[model samples]
Target: MSTTTYAVLVLIGILFFVAMDLGKRDKGNDVITLISDDDDQEEHS
Candidate 1:
């Protein structure tokens, strides 16, 4: 494979792993509460 192809493949692999990691973390309710709290504060301000 060419150098450019190899670099692209490596970049894609890194992104795939990062996405998988974020999926595994899966902070569902906490994220919702945090967002809601921020919105409430913004509205109050």
Candidate 2:
């Protein structure tokens, strides 16, 4: 009903989403990963 209430609801929603995401990651259901290799990406002239 108020700004503070809305903010708290949003925070709770975000925390729940993050908790689910972490659970999925632990189960290896996520496919995204970071494999950056700057040296291998150098310009080949």
Best by lDDT: 1
Local distance difference test values of all predictions, in order? 0.89, 0.70
Lowest summed lDDT across 10 adjacent residues in model 2 is found at 30-39
Candidate 1 per-residue lDDT, tens place, 1-45, comes to 699999999999999999977875787667778999999999999
Q: Candidate 1 at 21: error in angstroms?
A: 0.3
lDDT of 2 by residue, 9-43 (tens): 99999999999888877954333332224434654
lDDT (0-100) at residue 38 of candidate 2?
41
Per-model C-alpha RMSD: 4.0, 5.7
The list of candidate 1 runs beyond 4 A from truth reads 27-45
Candidate 2 segments whose C-alpha is farther than 4 A from its true place:
28-45
Candidate No. with top TM-score: 2
